[model samples]
Each structure stands twice: as structure tokens, then as C-alpha cells.
Target: GKDGSPLLCGSIPGLVPKQLRFCRNYIEIMPSVAEGVKLGIQECQHQFRGRRWNCTTIDDSLAIFGPVLDKATRESAFVHAIASAGVAFAVTRSCAEGTSTICGCDSHHKGPPGEGWKWGGCSEDADFGVLVSREFADARENRPDARSAMNKHNNEAGRTTILDHMHLKCKCHGLSGSCEVKTCWWAQPDFRAIGDFLKDKYDSASEMVVEKHRESRGWVETLRAKYSLFKPPTERDLVYYENSPNFCEPNPETGSFGTRDRTCNVTSHGIDGCDLLCCGRGHNTRTEKRKEKCHCIFHWCCYVSCQECIRIYDVHTCK
Candidate 1:
């Protein structure tokens, strides 16, 4: 126990070089970092569960998504952005919760007091979280390639989403239920809200073209909007350089597992609808019985008794 040996930071898998450096330097923050990555991944799956890609992860490898993220598709942009945002969100939350000694609540007040509210509570320090996320997530995009540029942009967009949603949360202080003074603090939005915002960004993501030029050191790739009339995407908009595959059939080339057995909503006309999810292949319907507690009666002692009931419903899956 006395020996100075690297513990958790040394054993974590899938970290690139720069991330390893950051991990070793800030070992105490690693748990929050891991939690952040998990949050990002879980949110990604939740947001894409009804879609073709589905944000599936590989169990056998550290690169969980495998080569699915190797391309510069809109999916890749969403993943990068969400992951980055997740890291920041988690770390910022940890800071407010007093999990780390290196950081704590933000004491800097941006402006003067509003109406009756004054800055007094411990505001979440998101800037530190963003810095740590950039150090680790941006480390993987060191190369001067088009994909790297696209990824970095999307990552920033994810972090910006958090910043954009930050708002003042206030509590009232007064005599006997009357409002007299209000203390406020800056707080991050709920992670689900962030996920929903990112999903919206994914749907309307901008398509970009790669432009390579010679610099003093070597060639560098930059991204530009493909369409001329469309307004240029800001720092908060997701950008992709390549289109995603249809993912209708299993194709190893495009890293698509297909939607052959995916569940579909029969009544929906949107992306999750059988018509779109099945790709015109139609769907198969089968009856499923579900058991649940049905009729219940309150007893004299206050406990309730319920009868078991069986219910039948139609289940649909892509053919």
C-alpha cells in the first residue's frame, strides 16, 4: 500500500497517448471522466434506439463502436459531440458535488444582481470540465486530416450545447413564506435535455466538403459547407463530410448491422414507423401476452390485494 504504483489510470483501456498523460496527471477525476463517457454512450443509444444505426457497441473491443466511427458521417459527428458533452457534464456535476479537491463551485459572477435575486449559492464550474474534456477527447484528433477537423468541430459543438443551456437557478429567502431575497446559481441543464438538443442537431446537421491546402509544415484539411445558399453552420451546429450508408442490409464495408430484426412502431409514420424502419420490406406481426396486476381492493388494514390479469397485444418486427 505504501509503494508508489499507478493504479486505476494505468489499467484503463482504450486511451490514446495524450489521454493517458491527462489521466495520469488527474487520476482523481478519472472516475467522473469514465462516468461522463458512459453518460454520453447511454444517451446516444437512447436517442438512436429507433433508428437504423442504433448506436450499438462491441463487447469484445475497447473501440466499442468499432469501425463504425471511422468515417466522417453525420453519425460520427453526433457521437463525438455527445461524448465530449458528456465528459463536461459529468465533471461539472462532480465539481459541484465536491468530488474533487482541485476544483469546486464557480465563484465568478458574470454581472450585477437581477430584480431581487443575487448570486450566492455555489454555482457549477463548467469551464474546468470543458477544459478536461478537451484535453482528453480532443487528444484523439491530433492529426491534420479532414476527419480530425470534423470531429473537433463536433466536439466543440457538444460542449457548446451545455454552455448554451446553462441558466440561473434561484431559491427564495423571506419571512414566513413571503418573498424578500433570492439567491441564484448557474446550473447545467438535465442530461436528457442535452441529449434531445444534440439529437435535433443531428437531424439538421450540415454537410461539409474537405479542402486541402499546403501549410508551412505540411498539408492541412479544412471543412466548408457543401451548399452555397444555406447559411454556414456555427460552432454549435454538427458538421459531416460524408453521407451515412442506408443500413438497410448487413454490410461489413459500411459497418452497418442492418435492421432486419429491429422492432418497429406500426402506427408511426416517422423514422421508427414500420414503413421506414423496415425499408419497404414490410414487417411481421405476432401476438404477445403480458401478465400484470389488475383489479385491486383496499383492505381494512390499508393493504391492497390485486388479481393477476393476462393481456394480449400485437408485436411487430422488421422482416
Candidate 2:
């Protein structure tokens, strides 16, 4: 019978009904058997998906085998092992070939003697490849383009390095130097880890400013309280106390008391002139008048008066 379903066994031409019962039973069980094989294939695909490998190659292999292995045999353990091995082999081969092509290495050559026996140099290049593979797996699981995801990772790494270098150099200390312009590279996703580091530095600076202001305020308060008690003097007091007349007591025996009538001849303006000479009284008050002469008072009391007056006036004038 040329039915639409695929033939599992050799075609049997024109057989009787009872003769074909055994064959029919086997045919009846084929869907269940195929279901088991499908389960095994699905498990293998899951395991491969979990492994880190190139996205393009994995997708291509899955697309090719998806329909062909839909009706595969599940009765034999050997077939299951072979299928799993096949999947693993395809993934590993794709990774190895891609690495060799990028690094200009011959994939056919055996790598150095080791347990894993890989062909790559197993240094920086291998590590980079491993990182790429892990990122590729992530992209696959997330249903994104692996190449674009890898590019994003590389760009972030580069930006992070630049931000870290800038942060290190920008000490902002007066002893060192400050960054002429402030930057918030810490807010970027790539530099998020160093955000805490920058925040600690910023907090430290803020604390210092607050402490300095507190100390300055304390010093000003102390000065204000100390100088609050003294009062200053006025300018009028300075002038009056500095210009008063001084007197000494007169001696009566020397004709220095009440001798107002005595006169002396003196030359005044090229002519002879007479002037009166007398000590006015026996008291401490003495007075003498002379023409064209400026009089000044000299006494210890006057000196002290003037000095105190000037000192007090200066404080008030300053304020």
C-alpha cells in the first residue's frame, strides 16, 4: 500500500490477513517506539543547549536533524549513545574549527599531549574563546544574536577600563590635584562595581568640609565671648582732658605772691616797652600773660589724662 506514512520495514507484496497480523502489530508499535526515540533526541538537544558552543553551528545542526530523526529507533541503547555522541561531536568540532580559523591554526594537527587534548594554544586566545562561547550560549537561550551580544560585552569591558583609570587619577585632594571637570562615570552599568568606591571618596570629602566649618564656628564664638565685657570711650573726652592749664603753688617770701605792680623794661618791636611782673596769689593757681607767645601746660596728671583718653578713644573709633 502506497500510504502517505513512511515504511518502517521491507514492503510485503499481496499477503493474506492472518499472515500479516504480526507485521501489523509491529507497525502498530512503531509510533510509540518513535516517540521514545524522539524523547532521547530531545534530551540530547537540551544537554547540547546547556553546553557553551557557537550559535550558528548549533542552530544549523538542529535544523538538519530535526525532521530526519523524528522517527528514529529507541529500542537499542547503542543507538542512543551514538546519537548523543554525534551531537557532542558536532558542537565540539564547530568550536575547534572556528578557533583554528580565527587563530590561523591547522585543525587537523594534534594539540599538545594532555587529558583533554585540545588544539588551541590554551592561553589568552582560548580564554577569550571560552568567554565568547559562554556569551553565545546566553544569547541563544535569550533568543538574541550571538555576535551582537559578544560585541556588547567587549564594548562594556573597554568602557569599564577607561572609567577605572580616570577614577584612580582623579584624587581631588588639594595636595594632589583635582579633575577640572566632574564626571559621573560611576553611574554607567559597566562601572557599577566601582560606584561604591567613588561614593566612599565623595562621602569622605563631605565630612571633611563639615568638620572644618564646625571648628571655625567654635573659634568665632570663643572670641566673641572673651571681648564682650570692655566698653570704649568718646572723642570729646580725648580733646578736653588733653588741653587744660597747669598751676604750681607760689612762695610768698620770694615776692612771688601778690607782687602784681613790679614792672620791667624790655625791647618790643624796636621800642622800649614796660611790662608788669607779679605772682598773682599764694595759692597753687598761677597765671602769666605774654604777647606773641603760645602757652602750654606740662604736668604728670595731664600726661596720664591724655594717655588714657587716647587709648579709650582709639577702641571706640576702631569699632
Candidate 3:
């Protein structure tokens, strides 16, 4: 499964081949692209684990992803950002490892020099990753409509986050006990960092507007004037064109699968908590018991002994 080869986008049922060709030069990293999409889905499900609409999948394997992305809700913005960031991270790493030839270590501005370190290691090329991601992911957003504009902008925002989070990592040497001299290199931040940053953006996502600019003679989408009270959004901000549904009941049209029978935290007062998740239908609680290794005693050497312990806890689920 780790084999590196040319991936034909059209071979996948739900994948959009038309826009994929925009990144034809990156065909060698096609496996990375598919992995990125899966990573995005996983991240989405993780982020929404406690919420009502918990990122469920459709009948087709990855086929529903493109259409699900077309919606202009806050969820859609998060999906686009996470998915695009996944691609950027994957391709950049592949480039650093010599698996892909279209890109290499970005020797651009290394970290600050006063830190007593010299840049040396081959860092992943986030610049190349972002460029390739924009070409492929944004290609599907061809319409001049607001939804398309929002998608393109959110996709770019995701790629930009990868570049913004690239940091300098270093190793010290040359002296017996001091870091007087060191070798540092730019490294892409971990996926969790990207996921956390994108989650924060998702929490504050703004509902936006798409309109024709008479002077510019093209379509433009931006945060509505009402949403601009604090400040106008920079290019990096995530913007959406529609408000999300309540997501309390199964609405096939809106993509909500409802929260009935979903597990919840009894102590939580927020979305994942029993109150909100059950939508006031109230929840059922049952006692669950399990056995686990416990009451352990440390041995003089490398081994420890333990006795089985029975644990009982209350499990809560929507009625």
C-alpha cells in the first residue's frame, strides 16, 4: 500500500478528476493525496466527536466527499481547510524524503540567525506543497458563485496555515558541553498542531457574502458587513456562505444524521454533554462493569505483577 506510482484520479468513484489534473505534475504523490483526504475526514470526525453532526460517511467510499464539501457551512470551511492542509503536509514530507521529484527542501528564509545555529538540514518544502495544493484543490471551484469563491478561499487558507506554522528545529554540537554552535532547519509542524489551529478557526468561522463587483467585473465573496464589526477578515480567515443546520434530527437534505442513541458525557454542559446532545429528550443511564489490570506491585527487576480489578461506571446514551 505504500507503493509509489502514478495515481489516476478517475479510477476513484467519488474523486473529481477534472480538477485533479491541475496537479498532474504531482501525480507521483497521488497516494499522499488519497491519504490526505482520509486524514481530513478523520480529523473532521475527531473535532466533531461530541457534536450532533459527527461527520458521518455516505454510502460511497469517499464519493460523497466532493458534494458534501460543496455546502457553504462552517463545517464545509473546516473540511476544506483540513483537507487542503493534509495534502500540503503529505506532499511536503514526500518531497523531503525524495519520494517525489516535483519539489524539494525550501531553502528560503531559514529561522533567525542570532540563535547560534546554522541552517543545514533538508526541511520539507511547504511552499511547493501550497502551490501544488492550490492548483489541484482549487481547480474544482470554477464557478463564479459565492459557494465556489468561499471554497477556493478556504482551501488557500488551509495551505497558508502549513507555511505559517513551519518552525526551526536544531541539533547542538561542536563543544563538549555547550550549544555554542548548532545546525537548525525549518520543519513542518505536526498534523495535530494544524488540526488545533483549524479547529479554533472553525469555532469562529464567519458567514460571508458573494457578490458581483461592478468595478472589478468579477465575483467576490467576503465577510458580510454585519460580521465585519470587529475587523475585516484577512486572506487567512475561514469564511462560509451559509449557517449550519441545527443538526438535532436526521435531515438527509442537510446531511445531519441526528443524535439519537449517540453516547454522551453525563457531566458535560456543552454540545457533547447529555443535555444538548439529547436535545432535551433526556438520556438513559446504565451501569457498565469491566475488568482491568490493577493493584500492581513493582518488582525488584524489570517485571511487575498485578491483580484483576472490577470497575463499574455509568454509561449515558440518548434515548
Q: Which candidate achieves the best lDDT against the true structure?
A: 1
lDDT by residue for model 2 over 1-319, one digit each (tens)?
A: 3242234333543333432443354343323323433433454433332111101112444343322212211111112232222222222333334433333222332234333222233121222222332332222223133222222332233222222333111122233455333212111122223223322221221100001113533421111111224332111010001111111122322211222222222332211122212122211222453343224446766542222111111110000
Q: Residue 228 in model 2: shift from native, Å? A: 99
Ranked by lDDT from best down, the candidates are: 1, 3, 2
Give each model's whole-structure lDDT. Answer: 0.91, 0.26, 0.78
Task: State each model's C-alpha RMSD to the native.
Answer: 1.9, 50.5, 3.2
Q: Per-residue CA lDDT of candidate 3, range 74-121, in tens?
A: 888988899998888888888888876566777776545765778777
On a 0 to 100 scale, what is the lDDT of residue 37 in model 1?
89
User: TM-score for every candidate vs. truth?
Assistant: 0.94, 0.15, 0.88
**Model 1 spans with C-alpha error above 4 angstroms:** 1-5, 297-304
Q: Model 2: what TM-score?
A: 0.15
What lDDT score is found at residue 180 in candidate 3? 80
Clashes of 3: 1
Q: Comparing 2 and 3 by TM-score, which wins?
A: 3
Q: What shift in Å separates residue 6 of candidate 2 from its native position after superposition?
A: 8.9
- Name the runs in model 3 displaced over 4 angstroms: 1-7, 14-24, 59-70, 174-178, 213-228
Q: Which candidate's TM-score is highest?
A: 1
